[model samples]
Target chain A: MKKIFSILFVTLLLFSCQPDEIPPIGEATDYIPMLTGTWKLNKFEQIDADAESKSFPAFATVKDLTNVFPGHPYTDFSITFNPDGTFTADPGSSYMQMLTSGDWEVDDTEFPSAIILSSGSETQTIALNSLADVILGKVEFKEERKQADTGKIKIKYIYSLSKTSEL
Target chain B: MRQLIIISILIFGTFVLKAQDALPKFTVTPSEIDALTENVVIEFDVTGTAVEGLTDVYIWSWAPGLNPSEMLLCYDQGSPSWGSISDNAKLEPVAGQPNKFRLSLPKTVTRAGVEVTFNNVAELFGVGDTPGKIKEFGFLLRSQDGGSGGKQTPGDMKTSITLLPLEFEPSYFRTFPAKVSKNDVVTAYLNLSLIESSENQKLSVSDAFTATVSLLDENGTVLLTSEAFETTFTSEKEHAFSFIAEMLGAFPEGKSLDDVSKCQVVFSGKVYNQDESFETVSTKVFEFDFQDYE
Candidate 1:
């Protein structure tokens, strides 16, 4: 009886010390409520990348353009995401291809990793940047530009939006 | 001299007129290295370049480091200082091969009047943002003697300095060259960044750090000593002090540099006590037996 009790106690202790599985935080629809606000450009990065590495290319340097052009056009950039599936942007040359007003929808109302935008007949998809403040709703994404013939990525423009204001 | 020039030009003309496959390749062997102590071979084929058909070529090279504005001569102090580096830095033609030449570099080179190890070499070469992180090394090929006409490679030849990240792990105290002659301009390097935290804290509040050197005989008898001199702080965590052994006056005044065998160095700083009084603190004497490179 004593031997059996010791074995049972040890087994119970092992089960108690088992690792906890953390549940994924927030559903895809959570992004909609958190993103319904106007956000200003807080950080802008230009990554000069080496496009030759096959598996994982690297950037030579990441230059911070936050304060370089204090009164310049890009600093005044802002965007607003509304709850009605519409958005407005004042990119101000901050990006080569950006829309001022468009109807938008996220691919996953549950996971919400990419956003699709349409204006008239033109449409584009931009992925969410999970490296920075992605799921937390500060709203970050990067545009990687590639060479025309080679299709190899050469430069990256990373934007992290901050100073959010909700209606 | 005129005949030599005419023959060189003739050879150059013949090589240029021939059907060539491609532009010559200027390269460095073992371009990437594990340690700064490793030597690299700079090789080039002069098939179509301006300096084609030359018997010998001189190398004029400098790795950019310490100062961002200027290039530091890549040759070590033990090699040759600037202005007289031609013959000492010439590239030799590869045996049995027609147009190939190579210059094998020493592990350490003199820069800014100091013999520096490769860790310092990588920093000086402007390859990376910090010491021991080297990306590339570049060089220019030239003639042994400088004048109107000399053989030289076209444009700039660059080679990667390391295949893997050559990290410099600081041991707190180091002497450049690892070995030194009596008159060699010995440099002492002090890195306080990785010292014991408490000792590092004591040095942070000290007025200034100072160093002294003692020349000892083989039996370990101190023959001469130098006055304590303040070291130059090259960076927030790095300091350097350089001296030649023979320059100082001997103990009573006339022992030659050759009589001195072993060399010992000490670094000191002032530390404050609990009573608001300060006392002198010093490193235990670190010594190295001098080599007869002469």
Candidate 2:
């Protein structure tokens, strides 16, 4: 009995030493570098909307973009952080004007790339697949969704960012 | 036991994710603004971590007290928000896209102390929230005095006179003929127009600004002096203000002055603002052709 208890203790110790099982090779850390610049949403789709098609030509190709979100929609937006603590948003193609000015704070963690924006009411989060994607600027992952009848499903969204503006 | 471990791992992962999701760093650089003849331009740039879903840019005109609508020229379309003015030339992804924006003053008026805002809605609300699909940003644009002084020509006041023949039949406004015979009782009509920007500028019609009318050889001076006039308006552009100088009399009762061709309409006026110190003298002369007289 004592032998069995000692063996159990050793097994538990080994399990604790191993790193937590990380999600599939999704978003990564290097993704941050790729996302360092402006990214216009040339294409987007409504996966849950009661529409037959997934993609729609609703938003125009945004050249004056100032921000982007990796995963979550409204809360995790991009910003061109200025020296004076001020920032600019990518004026979206929606009828509403894009580009907002404000301040921002980031959460340096592993899974949820959450950044809080100050200066306005909007707050958001972006989930990356891995540390590599965070520094690379391109994020590919499946977003989980629940259908009214089907219950749960995952929708995929890909983000490719570039340093569009030097100024 | 396995389920418990999975739950703990997920919770710990969430905590770590929150820590990594901290604010992406950034900075704002002051940009130069050009002073245009009709308006002013404010420009700037944002560099650092990419903050997404931002859509509104604000400009705060810092001049004497001004309305936001009057101060803000372009922004994201939300109320008090306008769309971007630049084209797609700078937004190409392959091209290093510079997130640039500009604010301008109205063309009709000039002012100082304007502040431009390039803000994400989160910043505007001061919540420090994540920028969602509808992001908002603002820039504080302060106007600078490249010190371009007032207009080159001061007191740009103008006046014009149209002499129409008196008409018996009329539509909306009374109509008038261009010429009339000496024996005919002629009622000459005059219309005046003025353009003043400031209240200090005034358009006063005095005997000095009146024209001397004379029929060929009418003995002494038959010149008539009309009453003086002044005008102002609620609109900003050109305005029409009129003063009629009418001279009514039978051509010397039955004897028409000889050489009626000498009959003429003279116009005179002096341009002066509130301060009577500066004045400009202007005059226009018109002649009546008796051969074509009614």
Candidate 3:
């Protein structure tokens, strides 16, 4: 009985000494290092707010969106996340061809997680569906037109991004 | 004999006074306005004599396609005239008496300037939301209690107004080497011209301006970009400028310039104020093909 008890204690100690499983990129406690890089859009889709909800494909490539949506002024169609928590983004093509610079923060407390970006007086929060070292997926929230009788309409946009460069 | 002569003079003088009372002299303030303004407030003041028998106010505007002289003939004959004039030219009574009317010109008028004529007519045309240009405008005042149901009445007064012309059209674009050869160095040239403003004012060359050139692939991807070169208008002629881009340097690994099936040169100009706080002027995109330079 003493030998068996001693052997069981030794087995538990060995198991505890082994390294734990590594957490995913965005799920890790220290996730700031994983986000410092240039990212390009890969897919964009929108889910409508309706009883019978419908999913619509918005754009697949930079050129397709520019042609379909005239007056889109962005050319590079990319976002660069810097080590200092600053970010620069080309928000597609527009009449102004303006590039937006802002600050970003990751919120890991939520069920899925979220990334908040603030530019000037505008702030946008994107919910992360999945995150990895080279790929990131988020759901964008939008409010459509409101109906007096039916209340307010809302939509969800899914965005997938791929890492293009490291900083 | 002296009494008879005095009586004749008094009768003639009375007729002349009646004629003067029928006509109302008009004064339109701020005759000029910026070309891009959406709306303009024109104040109308009647001088000379008190206007009586005023009923309706009629306004007509003319642009490049519309003829003011012909429109006047239509009004005189009470015919459906101004075939070329768009319905966007509108008039409303804002201040003074209900008889004192205000003309609400459309945004199109400011972009291209128009001529407007105003008079008092029995019929009133409805206003419109469409955009249109007017070079001259005029108004007429008429009275309901006039001869032949106001048709033969000469009591209505008329006058004309002018709009400032646009300083420039969108933009004229051109490029060199409409085609491209592989591995060749690319050089781009751009030119812009300034036109007279609504105030008949010319744009100053000393104004701070920047010209930027961008090279985009068929996928609308920006492969290369030139610096925002600061330049000034040196001549009234096309403000000529140029920039160079290395074609081979823009290619990715395992690729060459030949892989670029299609490319475009986009040139734009913007004018800013002294402190760069205000961007007052900007040109539309001037996109052209970026051919390979042999």
Candidate 4:
């Protein structure tokens, strides 16, 4: 009985000495290397302040919220992130389509992380949920606007990007 | 030598023209004030040629640290002290006050720029209101259709003044059952206490005060939202009120309850006066991560 008691005490001491496991808040290390390269849109999710959820195809031609592609559906659409902190989106192979280019940066200080993209005077800050070498997921910040005729509305958007090429 | 002199003359002429064409210098007298009243008397002046073409001028006033969302919530609930702007008030010189004019803001102003400045300004707070102490006071000037080629300043043109010699007392809050386990039905409770600047003025509770809770997943998507709970303070001495938020059942879509990344709780409180007029006292947002729970 004395030996069993000693063993149990030692076991409790060892368990108490173990450090607490920290939940995966996503790796905070520099993501510039993993961020550079070509990526294709894989999934899109949008949720409004009212708790309404909407799912869209990889590249849809809808005009309401998922209108990344103006007139044409986003089939085989891809965005290339260069090493110099610049990015360009492929507007398909059509000549009439306009090319979209912007600047991108990652902010690791904020929880869920954030990636700010600026195209001209308009800028959008996207909250990163999970990020890896091959997979990237993000949720757009909430936007609130008041219509002159209607009242007020709040909207949020989320996106998933998959690595396509390293070059 | 002759060619050099000619070039010098042309350069000087161009420089003079540009100086004359620069945007007018706008000024606001008594730039800072110690106290705010229902009607604030403001002075405006234009010292350059651009003043003649000035179609309209407006003034925007508000307390610093108040965000746009909070201001809008206040406006929706009828609290006017967050900030406000004048609606294209006619800019005529003061009768006996010289450049000083009686300015009244139609609504609250949120952003800068002549066109964007007039929209979304909130009303001002006085001695009896919550957060009566002013830390940073902001004043802005705008001319209609104003720009480099027009009558107004080109960019974000505004001045911020610091109010001195004032004490501040913000609302205090506390929460219960600050932690929860996965797959457990939990009720989050919150307590909020009000503050009064003067002893003579009593703080009355409004029925519109509510508290709401939201559970978000790893993707910052809302997994569940609790119904907003209504609350009211019973007495002035015991100025604290409490509310409960209930989270029921397991999360949908077979997602593990432990995967919830964050929880947000928002408390919107309002107070009333002797005449039964109520205004939003405060709107506070609190965010908790999974680690905050036991």
DockQ of 4: 0.02
Residue-wise C-alpha lDDT for candidate 1, range A88-122, written one tens digit per residue: 88867443246778988888876777778778998
Predicted structure 4: clash tally: 16
Q: Write the per-residue lDDT of candidate 1 for residues B99-182, one digit (tens) a residue.
A: 788755552455555565443344334432233333344555556545555444543434223335443235677665344556
Candidate 1's docking class is incorrect
Task: Give the proportion of true interface contacts each model preserves, from 0 to 1.
Answer: 0.00, 0.00, 0.00, 0.00
Chain A TM-score from candidate 4: 0.51
Q: Across residues B1-294, which tens digit of lDDT does each residue of candidate 3 receive?
A: 999999999998887676555544444444554323444555433333333324344444323334333333224333435332323333354565653555543322211234433221101121111112334444444332234344211322235445454332222443222222322222233343434343112233324555665555667665655556544333333443433344123555554444454444443443456787553454555555543231
lDDT tens digits, residue span A105-147, model 2 = 4466343454444656764333333334434444322222333
Off by over 4 Å in 4: A1-27, A46-48, A51-71, A93-99, A109-112, A119-122, A127-153, B1-294
Comparing 1 and 3 on lDDT, the stronger one: 1
Point to the candidate with the largest TM-score.
1
Q: List chain B TM-scores, each candidate.
A: 0.41, 0.23, 0.38, 0.32
Clashing pairs in 1: A28-A110, B64-B124, B65-B124, B75-B110, B76-B109, B76-B110, B77-B110
Number of the candidate with higher TM-score, 1 or 3: 1
What's the count of clashing pairs in each model shown? 7, 149, 34, 16
Off by over 4 Å in 2: A1-35, A49-86, A95-99, A109-112, A126-160, B1-294
lDDT (Cα) of model 3: 0.43
Where does the lowest 10-residue lDDT sum fall in candidate 1 chain A? Answer: A51-60
lDDT (Cα) of model 4: 0.45
Residue B243's lDDT within candidate 1 is 66
| Model 3 CA deviation exceeding 4 Å by range | A1-167, B1-30, B34-37, B47-55, B60-91, B94-99, B107-139, B144-158, B167-212, B215-294
TM-score of each: 0.34, 0.20, 0.29, 0.26
